[model samples]
Target: MQQTFFDLEVALASLPRILEGLWLNIQVLVAASIGVLLFALVLATLRALRGPA
Candidate 1:
Protein backbone atom coordinates (compact mmCIF):
# COMPACT_ATOMS: atom_id res chain seq x y z
CA MET A 1 0.00 0.00 0.00
CA GLN A 2 2.87 2.36 0.80
CA GLN A 3 4.57 1.67 -2.54
CA THR A 4 1.30 2.23 -4.34
CA PHE A 5 0.98 5.63 -2.75
CA PHE A 6 4.51 6.54 -3.86
CA ASP A 7 3.78 5.44 -7.40
CA LEU A 8 0.63 7.44 -7.43
CA GLU A 9 2.52 10.50 -6.30
CA VAL A 10 5.02 10.12 -9.15
CA ALA A 11 2.24 9.68 -11.65
CA LEU A 12 0.49 12.79 -10.40
CA ALA A 13 3.68 14.81 -10.75
CA SER A 14 4.06 13.78 -14.38
CA LEU A 15 0.41 14.27 -15.25
CA PRO A 16 0.78 17.91 -16.31
CA ARG A 17 3.44 17.11 -18.92
CA ILE A 18 1.33 14.28 -20.28
CA LEU A 19 -1.74 16.49 -20.46
CA GLU A 20 0.23 19.28 -22.12
CA GLY A 21 1.34 16.97 -24.91
CA LEU A 22 -2.18 15.69 -25.35
CA TRP A 23 -3.52 19.24 -25.54
CA LEU A 24 -0.98 20.15 -28.20
CA ASN A 25 -1.91 17.10 -30.25
CA ILE A 26 -5.57 17.95 -29.95
CA GLN A 27 -4.97 21.49 -31.18
CA VAL A 28 -3.04 20.25 -34.19
CA LEU A 29 -5.70 17.71 -35.04
CA VAL A 30 -8.43 20.35 -34.82
CA ALA A 31 -6.53 22.72 -37.08
CA ALA A 32 -5.88 20.00 -39.61
CA SER A 33 -9.53 18.99 -39.58
CA ILE A 34 -10.66 22.53 -40.24
CA GLY A 35 -8.21 22.90 -43.14
CA VAL A 36 -9.33 19.64 -44.72
CA LEU A 37 -12.98 20.59 -44.39
CA LEU A 38 -12.43 23.96 -46.01
CA PHE A 39 -10.53 22.42 -48.91
CA ALA A 40 -13.20 19.81 -49.36
CA LEU A 41 -15.95 22.44 -49.38
CA VAL A 42 -14.15 24.50 -52.01
CA LEU A 43 -13.61 21.47 -54.23
CA ALA A 44 -17.24 20.50 -53.91
CA THR A 45 -18.37 23.96 -54.87
CA LEU A 46 -16.08 24.03 -57.90
CA ARG A 47 -17.24 20.61 -58.98
CA ALA A 48 -20.87 21.63 -58.73
CA LEU A 49 -20.23 24.67 -60.89
CA ARG A 50 -18.31 22.70 -63.50
CA GLY A 51 -21.34 21.17 -65.29
CA PRO A 52 -22.83 24.61 -66.18
CA ALA A 53 -19.65 25.75 -67.86
Candidate 2:
Protein backbone atom coordinates (compact mmCIF):
# COMPACT_ATOMS: atom_id res chain seq x y z
CA MET A 1 0.00 0.00 0.00
CA GLN A 2 1.05 3.56 -0.72
CA GLN A 3 -0.14 6.92 0.58
CA THR A 4 0.55 10.48 -0.44
CA PHE A 5 -0.63 12.57 2.50
CA PHE A 6 0.73 10.47 5.35
CA ASP A 7 3.77 8.24 5.70
CA LEU A 8 4.19 5.84 8.61
CA GLU A 9 7.94 5.39 8.27
CA VAL A 10 8.59 9.12 8.29
CA ALA A 11 6.28 9.62 11.24
CA LEU A 12 7.91 6.84 13.22
CA ALA A 13 11.37 8.30 12.59
CA SER A 14 10.25 11.68 13.95
CA LEU A 15 8.61 10.29 17.07
CA PRO A 16 11.56 10.69 19.45
CA ARG A 17 12.15 14.33 18.60
CA ILE A 18 8.45 15.00 18.93
CA LEU A 19 8.40 13.36 22.35
CA GLU A 20 11.37 15.45 23.49
CA GLY A 21 9.67 18.64 22.39
CA LEU A 22 6.49 17.61 24.19
CA TRP A 23 8.42 16.96 27.39
CA LEU A 24 10.21 20.31 27.15
CA ASN A 25 6.85 22.02 26.73
CA ILE A 26 5.46 20.24 29.78
CA GLN A 27 8.42 21.33 31.91
CA VAL A 28 8.05 24.93 30.78
CA LEU A 29 4.35 24.85 31.55
CA VAL A 30 4.91 23.51 35.05
CA ALA A 31 7.66 26.06 35.81
CA ALA A 32 5.49 28.90 34.54
CA SER A 33 2.59 27.76 36.69
CA ILE A 34 4.74 27.60 39.80
CA GLY A 35 6.17 31.07 39.15
CA VAL A 36 2.70 32.52 38.68
CA LEU A 37 1.42 30.92 41.86
CA LEU A 38 4.40 32.18 43.88
CA PHE A 39 3.92 35.70 42.54
CA ALA A 40 0.24 35.69 43.39
CA LEU A 41 0.93 34.38 46.85
CA VAL A 42 3.47 37.13 47.48
CA LEU A 43 1.01 39.80 46.39
CA ALA A 44 -1.77 38.35 48.48
CA THR A 45 0.45 38.15 51.54
CA LEU A 46 1.50 41.75 51.09
CA ARG A 47 -2.07 42.86 50.74
CA ALA A 48 -3.05 41.02 53.88
CA LEU A 49 -0.14 42.38 55.88
CA ARG A 50 -0.64 45.93 54.59
CA GLY A 51 1.63 47.80 57.11
CA PRO A 52 1.23 45.44 60.00
CA ALA A 53 4.85 44.34 60.09
Candidate 3:
Protein backbone atom coordinates (compact mmCIF):
# COMPACT_ATOMS: atom_id res chain seq x y z
CA MET A 1 0.00 0.00 0.00
CA GLN A 2 1.06 3.62 -0.65
CA GLN A 3 1.83 5.85 2.31
CA THR A 4 1.05 9.54 2.84
CA PHE A 5 3.16 12.57 3.79
CA PHE A 6 1.49 12.58 7.17
CA ASP A 7 2.59 9.01 7.71
CA LEU A 8 6.13 9.89 6.77
CA GLU A 9 6.10 12.92 9.05
CA VAL A 10 4.71 10.95 11.91
CA ALA A 11 7.31 8.23 11.51
CA LEU A 12 10.14 10.74 11.37
CA ALA A 13 8.75 12.68 14.32
CA SER A 14 8.66 9.54 16.40
CA LEU A 15 12.44 9.33 16.42
CA PRO A 16 14.88 11.61 18.27
CA ARG A 17 16.49 14.54 16.48
CA ILE A 18 19.62 12.42 16.28
CA LEU A 19 19.71 12.13 12.50
CA GLU A 20 21.61 15.39 12.14
CA GLY A 21 23.54 14.59 15.27
CA LEU A 22 24.54 11.22 13.79
CA TRP A 23 25.71 12.86 10.57
CA LEU A 24 27.95 15.20 12.55
CA ASN A 25 29.22 12.30 14.63
CA ILE A 26 30.09 10.29 11.51
CA GLN A 27 31.90 13.29 10.01
CA VAL A 28 33.92 13.79 13.16
CA LEU A 29 34.80 10.11 13.30
CA VAL A 30 36.03 10.14 9.70
CA ALA A 31 38.15 13.23 10.35
CA ALA A 32 39.51 11.68 13.53
CA SER A 33 40.40 8.48 11.67
CA ILE A 34 42.34 10.42 9.07
CA GLY A 35 44.15 12.38 11.75
CA VAL A 36 44.97 9.24 13.72
CA LEU A 37 46.32 7.54 10.60
CA LEU A 38 48.53 10.52 9.79
CA PHE A 39 49.71 10.70 13.39
CA ALA A 40 50.50 7.00 13.31
CA LEU A 41 52.66 7.51 10.25
CA VAL A 42 54.53 10.29 12.05
CA LEU A 43 54.98 8.06 15.07
CA ALA A 44 56.33 5.25 12.91
CA THR A 45 58.85 7.65 11.38
CA LEU A 46 59.91 8.77 14.84
CA ARG A 47 60.27 5.19 15.98
CA ALA A 48 62.50 4.48 12.98
CA LEU A 49 64.80 7.27 14.18
CA ARG A 50 65.70 5.31 17.33
CA GLY A 51 66.72 7.26 20.50
CA PRO A 52 67.07 11.07 20.44
CA ALA A 53 70.41 12.22 19.04
Candidate 4:
Protein backbone atom coordinates (compact mmCIF):
# COMPACT_ATOMS: atom_id res chain seq x y z
CA MET A 1 0.00 0.00 0.00
CA GLN A 2 1.14 3.54 -0.82
CA GLN A 3 -0.12 7.05 -0.13
CA THR A 4 0.07 9.98 -2.53
CA PHE A 5 -0.05 13.73 -1.97
CA PHE A 6 -1.52 14.70 -5.33
CA ASP A 7 -4.72 13.17 -6.59
CA LEU A 8 -5.62 14.04 -10.20
CA GLU A 9 -9.05 12.44 -9.98
CA VAL A 10 -10.17 14.53 -7.02
CA ALA A 11 -8.80 17.73 -8.51
CA LEU A 12 -10.49 17.20 -11.87
CA ALA A 13 -13.81 16.47 -10.22
CA SER A 14 -13.69 19.78 -8.30
CA LEU A 15 -12.24 21.95 -11.06
CA PRO A 16 -15.57 23.21 -12.37
CA ARG A 17 -16.75 24.31 -8.94
CA ILE A 18 -13.42 25.94 -8.26
CA LEU A 19 -13.57 27.88 -11.51
CA GLU A 20 -17.12 29.06 -10.78
CA GLY A 21 -16.04 30.37 -7.39
CA LEU A 22 -13.02 32.04 -8.93
CA TRP A 23 -15.24 33.87 -11.41
CA LEU A 24 -17.45 35.11 -8.63
CA ASN A 25 -14.40 36.35 -6.75
CA ILE A 26 -13.21 38.21 -9.83
CA GLN A 27 -16.53 40.04 -10.14
CA VAL A 28 -16.41 41.06 -6.49
CA LEU A 29 -12.85 42.29 -6.87
CA VAL A 30 -13.72 44.46 -9.85
CA ALA A 31 -16.70 45.97 -8.09
CA ALA A 32 -14.63 46.73 -5.00
CA SER A 33 -11.85 48.29 -7.07
CA ILE A 34 -14.30 50.59 -8.81
CA GLY A 35 -15.83 51.63 -5.53
CA VAL A 36 -12.44 52.46 -4.06
CA LEU A 37 -11.43 54.48 -7.08
CA LEU A 38 -14.64 56.53 -6.93
CA PHE A 39 -14.18 57.18 -3.21
CA ALA A 40 -10.57 58.29 -3.71
CA LEU A 41 -11.57 60.60 -6.52
CA VAL A 42 -14.17 62.29 -4.29
CA LEU A 43 -11.65 62.64 -1.44
CA ALA A 44 -9.04 64.13 -3.74
CA THR A 45 -11.51 66.58 -5.22
CA LEU A 46 -12.49 67.79 -1.74
CA ARG A 47 -8.87 68.24 -0.77
CA ALA A 48 -8.19 70.20 -3.94
CA LEU A 49 -10.96 72.72 -3.19
CA ARG A 50 -9.96 76.24 -2.16
CA GLY A 51 -11.08 76.78 1.41
CA PRO A 52 -9.82 77.44 4.96
CA ALA A 53 -9.10 74.10 6.61
| TM-scores for all predictions | 0.74, 0.83, 0.60, 0.79
lDDT of 1 at 28: 100
Residue 8's lDDT within candidate 1 is 78
Deviation in angstroms for 6 in model 2? 0.6
**lDDT tens digits, residues 15-49, model 2?**
99999999999999999999999999999998888
Query: What lDDT score belongs to each candidate, Candidate 1 first?
Result: 0.91, 0.92, 0.86, 0.93
Ten contiguous residues minimizing lDDT sum, candidate 2: 1-10
lDDT of 4 at 21: 100
Q: Write the per-residue lDDT of candidate 4 for residues 1-53, one digit (tens) a residue.
A: 75545878877988999999999999999999999999999999999999975
Q: What TM-score does model 4 achieve against the real structure? A: 0.79
TM-score preference between candidates 1 and 4, better one: 4
On a 0 to 100 scale, what is the lDDT of residue 16 in model 1?
100
Tens digit of per-residue lDDT, candidate 1, span 27-46:
99999999999999999999
**TM-score: which is higher, 2 or 4?**
2
Greater lDDT among 1 and 3 belongs to: 1
Ranking by lDDT: 4, 2, 1, 3
Q: What is the lDDT of residue 38 in candidate 3?
A: 100
Number of the candidate with higher lDDT, 1 or 2:
2
* True-structure lDDT of candidate 4: 0.93
After superposition on all C-alphas, the RMSD of every candidate to the true structure, in Å, is 3.4, 3.4, 5.3, 2.4
How many pairs collide in each candidate, listed in order?
0, 0, 0, 0
Give the C-alpha miss distance for residue 3 in model 4, angstroms.
Answer: 7.2
Candidate 4 collision pairs: none
Question: Can you write out model 3's per-residue Cα lDDT over 4-35, one digit (the tens) per residue?
Answer: 66696777885566687888899999999999
lDDT measured at residue 34 in model 2 versus the true structure, 0 to 100: 100
Q: Model 1: residues >4 Å from true position, as ranges?
A: 1-6, 51-53
